[model samples]
Target: MDSFVNFFKKIPNKFASSAKELGKVQGIAIIAMLLALRVVLGMFANIGLAFNPYVKIGFTFLPMALVAYYFGPVCSMITACLGDVLSYVFAPAGASFTPGITAGYIIEACLLGIILYKEKISLPRTIICEVLVTLIGSLAINTYFIYMFYGLTYLQLLGLRAATLIPWAIIEGILVAVVVKALNRVPAISKNLPTT
Candidate 1:
């Protein structure tokens, strides 16, 4: 479909914009701060759920989401990759390394950046973006990786994921909407906002 093609086309544009933005020292500093925040948040905020072996309720995504919004796809993706890698190293969430899950993080960050960067903050868009990321990254891709790394079957993992991530996605959508709207009040974060 034309929409699908256009969507792919937009990815490169977002990456190019991200690279350009990161060329600035301010941009690099912002990304480093976000990455460090993500790791710290990851270290402290994650609460492993007793109901699921792999599920954890965490607030680390907040910084990564901000990175996606304030920076661009490239920065968001890089931050996500490093943030996750370092978090696992420092925090040790009790899971072994699975590259597929790491890939999911990068995809999730880039997807959010692409959907949200330079766009107006809105409830509908926030919900849509969060749900898409949850479905694709958290549910599908992550479930696959979890199954590969752990012992759960795909169906079992999918069921467990649906139980946790659906509600988490709703909460994440509202949180992102609120935070982004508030951040837009700052001239720095709002600098990238598309002008009417």
Candidate 2:
């Protein structure tokens, strides 16, 4: 209803504010560094779980979440897209580049920004955000892409992806909360973060 409509209305303003971050040299440097980290982590550090090539556990989410926290949704979305594309370019995986998978990561970044930007980082909030991202971005969106590419039944794909996604989300949520809290203790880093 009205609240829902108002939420949509605010999105543009949020994006606008996020876009302004690009005007700052520090912002550009931070986002570029983080995006590079995301690409590297995605390419090399990912662990294939359950012997399923489709399912992976990676720390790429950390940089994306950090981007969301620092720069907001637009920057996070850009970072997500670039990270995926760059990873593919540097280390080609699968038969082809899948736009749907990139879309899933974009959704993940946006969700992270919406939940974490300018908000106090807490265990509950981080857990909820990660869970939602897992459900929507990984289980739903990425699964669809994987199904399309691999010709696997949707149910089978969902089951395989979910086997690790749930635990990974919870673990990642805890990690994000802890890392952000620890980072905030550093005056240099905290000074750069957006105030709630």
Best by lDDT: 2
TM-score for each model: 0.88, 0.91
Q: What lDDT score belongs to each candidate, Candidate 1 first? A: 0.83, 0.89
lDDT digits (tens) for residues 1-196 of candidate 1:
9977876777778778878877788778878987999999889988888887678888877888888877778888999999989998997865576778899999999898998776667888888888899899888888897777667789988998789988898899889889978877889766744331
Q: List candidate 1 segments past 4 Å from native.
A: 1-9, 187-196
Quote model 2's TM-score. Answer: 0.91
- Give the CA lDDT, 0 to 100, for residue 47 in model 1: 81
Could you say which candidate leads in TM-score?
Answer: 2
Backbone clash pairs for candidate 1 read: none
